[model samples]
Target chain A: MNIKEYIDTANKKALERMASVQPILIDIELEAKNIIPGMDNKTILHAGPPIEWERMCGPTQGAIAGILVYEGLAADLTEGYEIAASGEIKFDCNHDHDTVGPMTGITSPHQPVFVLEDELTGKKAYCTLNEGRGRVLRFGGWNKEVLDRLNWMKSVLAPTLKKAIKHSDGINIKTIIAESLHMGDEGHNRNRSGSYLFLSELTPHMLDTTNNEIAKEVFLFIKKNADIFHLNLSMPHSKLIADAARDIDYCSLVVAMARNGTDIGIQVSSLGREWFTSPASIVEGLYFPGYSEKDACPDLGDSTISEVIGIGGFAMAASPAIVSFVGGSAREATLRTRRMYEISAGTSSIFTIPSLDFKGTPVGIDIRKVVELDETPLINTGIAHKEAGIGQIGAGLTAAPYDMFKDALKAFGAKYL
Target chain B: MKSNMNDLLSEGPKVINIGLRSFYEASETQGIKVVHIDWKPPAQGDIETIKLLDRLL
Candidate 1:
């Protein structure tokens, strides 16, 4: 077949695989090593592509140090730094282990992980529970309070969720994602509606399975921080969906977009696991009080998995409230979603935006379209402090550096049609 | 709602371009067709007016 015919066939196969994905929240479990194979005491999985400890940026290094302290491998921040620099710890990408995490995307051996299984493909992906906002380890916060919360999640929250999830066969995440989109959640940076919907589904099971006090506290924690409770669930859900489209020869679909504070990376589906990386761009958007651009680190997170699967920034039209956080008007949010459609290979078979007349959100980021149009994928992300321990300074939007897509396209042409 | 790939592949998928000519041009580049709708916000980008119109509509 010629190049045109070859590309057409590849696109068809990629889109079919994408449409077949059905991600279900199957269970919550303790010990990341148990669910995520190859995870060990010496292994540390982080977001984005692999980088040496010496090359890691402030926030990522900060998070690594925090994980070391939290895991009891190191006594404190100073000791943690020494341990990281000593090269005794093994660092790898989360994607390599069928796991995903938001922000710094640190997955230690001992943390509790939510497991998502694609019903159509029976592929499983894992992500740790959301630590909520400030001083969280994902954003490089390694303080005592951060360690305490991680411990609490392992001891209390994880067990509670495990019991609640076990009571049901599995939670159909696609249904909640669709319903939440209508109720004003883009299923990424803004998950207020999605969080509420998730709690509503699980609260009944929690009530039946757990003691009153425990159930009440879990419900309150979910309710109080309704904005991001669904992030962990969404990350793994996106991972399962995106993974379905991987390894299709000659297809130009973007399967992953992630960033460490130091570098941003993209992996094209047909390229297998090869990453095209560029310098992580500093985000341009609103900042939190007492914080400014000077204090913000470059865009960081594996949360762009949401965008890869066609929600988050790509579904911004569905959540106008996100504009307040990302620094844009409601109309601009709608336009952002529309603009994504221009470069996408197809619309999502699941996630749809209500405001766009219930149209399916754009899906399948085509590198060919991106390079041809000179448009890059837009990612909505949390800004980490340039200093690791300061945690999230703000949330904002940033474009995937055009060079990543250009590089991927170049590699695609060289490897295949 | 699930969108079928066939619909996108079929000829004459009408696009209503709102503001940017670049979007219309981009669609043309992809072998898709477009009809540029020469449109602007009512009341010329006035926030209060737009809010009032939103309520009135």
Candidate 2:
């Protein structure tokens, strides 16, 4: 098909996929069952293209090492290396359970994940908690403070949010996402607005339905940890909707993309359960003080699923303020999101873009477009350091490796037509 | 009433974070300098200094 015809057909299919969309919320059990949650981790959490992690920039390595220690599977860095080499710890992706997470893609068993369940199709997706900042465990900072914080999230924060959500019969993420975009959040890198919106929704419920003591404590914690505590919820909510778009026969859509620290993988709607993988790409961009690009990890984890389904950076125009967090300009933000239309299947009904004059954000990824147009999916990602202990260094954009798509196409051609 | 932009511009050369993909044409008259900082290897708070040189009239 010609590109326009191809795009039109793809758009129609994407719309259909979106119409069937639903949100799923779930808590993942990271029992060393060979799965890691989130997109960038699923793609190249290891050491190859679409990303090459062996030459990874440093902070990423530190994060991975920290997660190993956190998991208690390794005594130290040396042992972790042996374990990774031995492949004793299987790196399963959270997308396998329809989940996503932030950098380092570390979702351990004890962690509580907010699963967004799309009530329509009964599909469920998961994402871990957003531990309030400063050398977080997921970014490869596994200090005692990080461990303690993770424990607190499991014991305190998760239960409170769960209670609040249950009281409200679950949160309607689409409404919040749309509102946040207008309030200067792109719903990925800049979730400040979304978090406030979430708190606003949960606050009333927490106050009324919850016991006064629990309500007071939850409110205090959320107020203190307001650097977008709801991001974890947003990621899984996106996953829930994205999962509803998965596995249609003859559909060339992308169902999911997620990663563990060791591998990056993508699942196409047509291909169903198969994963297209490349090594995670090392992030290259501006760095914090005393840190350089050298400290960043190759891209790892499922956060990109938001971008794939449109919202993260793809909705950059909707959140011009994001320019401050990820580094770019207002015009660039507008274009980044607009360009996604070249490869997408359709726009979302629930997640509309305010800056684009209320046009819907692009939704549904098409693998056929990836091949026919030679345009891979673009993802805005957080940059973890390359070394085993350093943690997050920065965030930037990374495209899916082209070879994975080419390979998937070759495989599809052999089987379908 | 005072405007937010008026207050913001008065701060002068503040460090702002943004994604690499968000760049576009910036204004020349405002004396605003835009420096591009990469978000890779995300540091705690990385800031870049932008010095805007006047274009020949």
Candidate 3:
């Protein structure tokens, strides 16, 4: 085919891929089946950028070990050491299940997750509950406190969320996200507005079912960390939409997000179920007080994938405060978001950008754009310590490596006519 | 006249405020008319003046 034919074919393939793709809900219960609940040495944890054990960051590794001890998967440090060597227990990447874990992102059988389903195409995605604690599972740590907390989430928080969501007749997260962006949230790195919106929508239901005292605590929990609570929704929401654009043989769209506690992996639209991975780059940005890059984990988690589907960093212009968190000027945020247009195939009908005079937010990542411009998508993500249990140490900006897509594209070209 | 000058700059028109003396003299000597009207908002920033000299036509 000539260049014109190629261009037309590529664009059409991308659009068709996006339209046919569906986000499926992979219930956490289903995922948990793979894990033998309670810690055992058999379970091993890994992290971002494909680093060796010696090079592994501290906090993430700590979290991984902590979960093992907590789960009783191993007796103690000595036995856990033996278990690690015995390799009797299973160690796996969250991405293998169409899930992305934050920091340590350790999800075991005992944990319950909100499986976000794509009603259109019957595909599903999974993510663990928002560990009310800052440095919980996603960051890789399990201790008595963490275990107790996870128990509460499974027994109390998850059920309450279910009841509340059911009471509200299903939360239209996309709507809340769009509204929040206008109210100063880019929908990822920062979620103050979205958090409030979520609470407001869920309050009536929460109030109707529970007593004022119980309701108050749950309300406070959501309100206090309204910023991060919405993260759970954003991840599944992005997964839902990205899944919507999946499985068109020749269509090019993004399908998966994985951080092996080492490198980040992404699947492409036309690539057809194959992962295109790149070294997880270190995040660059301002951190919370007393925290520095040294305390931060390399880029880990599936949350950044939300930006890949648009509304994370791509809508940064709408939330200027993120400049402080993700390390860039307000103008740079605007430019960064606008730059995404160079790599995307379309804009989301549900999400809009306020800074660009309210243009539709870019969505549906196109491999052709990546190949043609050599520009990969930019994701704003949180930093966790390499050791497990230390929790979140910071937040920053990281770009998807182009090499992954370039390789995927090569594979795609060779496969198709 | 001074008040009118300020009003012209403030409400009447957006012109460079040549001092009252020069403006008054220019109007007086050049047959230009100066009118004092109700104080309105200043003219917008779009007005410009053009000059053409008749050479050997």
Candidate 4:
């Protein structure tokens, strides 16, 4: 067989491996460092590809400072910022640590993380618990309110969830995501449906595991924060499937695409951990009353991982309601999904869209198709305020840079040909 | 003579707007049927990148 045959077979094998993954929410860990590979007491895991403190964006730096205080390493938020800049802290990519995080993706040891295991392979992925809406740490808001919320999660929320998930045995994340798409969640910027489904699934178990008072508190917390509460679960579930598809010889399928506020990066299946990066793009969408485009950060967060497996932006056709939040017409939403099929290597058998006549969501972003057709992967993401201390101002859509895909394709030629 | 203008009046001129959604949207507001296609020059208009992409399987 020729090179085309070899590549075709390898891509098929990679997609099959990805499809075999069954991500189950196994348990919640009180301390992430105990489980996340290479994570230590002083290490702060961030999103996207790797970068150090000096080059870190405002939100990322702000998050690191707040996490330092939250971890008790610093006397106060000021000292936390000082220590972060002091080079005493080691910042690494969450993706490199077998974990994933939301905007700024600042995760420390003490923060509670949900543990997900790919039942097919026993491979696990972790993500810090989501901190609901505005004035939260993920969007760079760090203060008494933010740290207080973190403390509540670590002391109250995490332990309660730990018990409830244990009592339920395990909840299948793929099932929730598959159902969420049908109910108007693309599993990235909009996860209200997924959050509702997750809470409903775990509520009964919480009653059995914890006292009624504690169960009621946890239930109310999730209920009010349903806006993006399920995003943490979706991130790791995407990572698990992407991890399962990694490192196939001659496979040009993209396994991961993430942003660290400063730069956006992607890793193709055969490229292993090598990152092809470019400056992150500015998101174009509506903003809340006071904020404007100038106030928003360049595309931030590892949440784009949702688009890695063809949900999020790729399945926009499934969620017309998103147009109101992300700034586009309902027709444009269906067009987005229709266009993704041209670039994807295969359609997901598990996640299907109802509006599109139950067609599988486009899966497996093939880099060759992207560069050849000049179409890049787009993700629906939340907008972070460029300045620290301000949380999410809005939600919107953004596309990955084409230069990264071109560079990845060039590297693929040098490596295989 | 049966003119071309007569033909356009009976069968409206179909508009296929390429590369800009704004243009198609403007036409739609006027109650004209139009289709929008998002397009761009392939490979960033870089000939070398385009050629390299083709060479790889």
Top of the candidates by lDDT: 4
Scanning candidate 1 chain A in windows of ten residues, the lowest lDDT window is A408-417
TM-score of 1: 0.87
Q: Which numbered prediction scores highest in TM-score against the true structure?
A: 4
lDDT of 3 by residue, A16-64 (tens): 5444444432333423445323333343433332334444455555555
lDDT scores of the candidates, listed in order: 0.85, 0.63, 0.64, 0.90
Per-residue lDDT value at A161 in model 4: 94
Encode model 4's per-residue lDDT on A1-417: one tens digit a residue. 777788889989988998899999999989988999998898999999999898988998888888888888988878988999998888899999899999999889888899999997799999999989879999999779998889999999999999989998799999999999999998987899999999999999999989999999989999998968999999999999998889899999999899999999999999889999999988988799998889999999999899889899999999998989999998999999998998999999999999989999999999988998888998888899998888888878887898899899999988877
Candidate 2 vs candidate 3: which has greater DockQ?
Answer: 2
Residue pairs clashing in model 1 are: none
Query: Per-prediction fnat values?
Result: 0.00, 0.00, 0.00, 0.63
**lDDT per residue as tens, model 1, A319-367:** 9998888888999999999999988988876788878878999998988
Candidates' TM-scores?
A: 0.87, 0.75, 0.76, 0.95
Docking class of 3: incorrect
Off by over 4 Å in 3: A1-31, A34-60, A69-72, A75-85, A141-143, A289-291, B1-57
Supply the TM-score for candidate 2. Answer: 0.75
- Report the CAPRI category for model 4: medium
Query: What local lDDT score does residue A52 receive in model 3, on the 0 to 100 scale?
Result: 41
Candidates ranked by lDDT: 4, 1, 3, 2
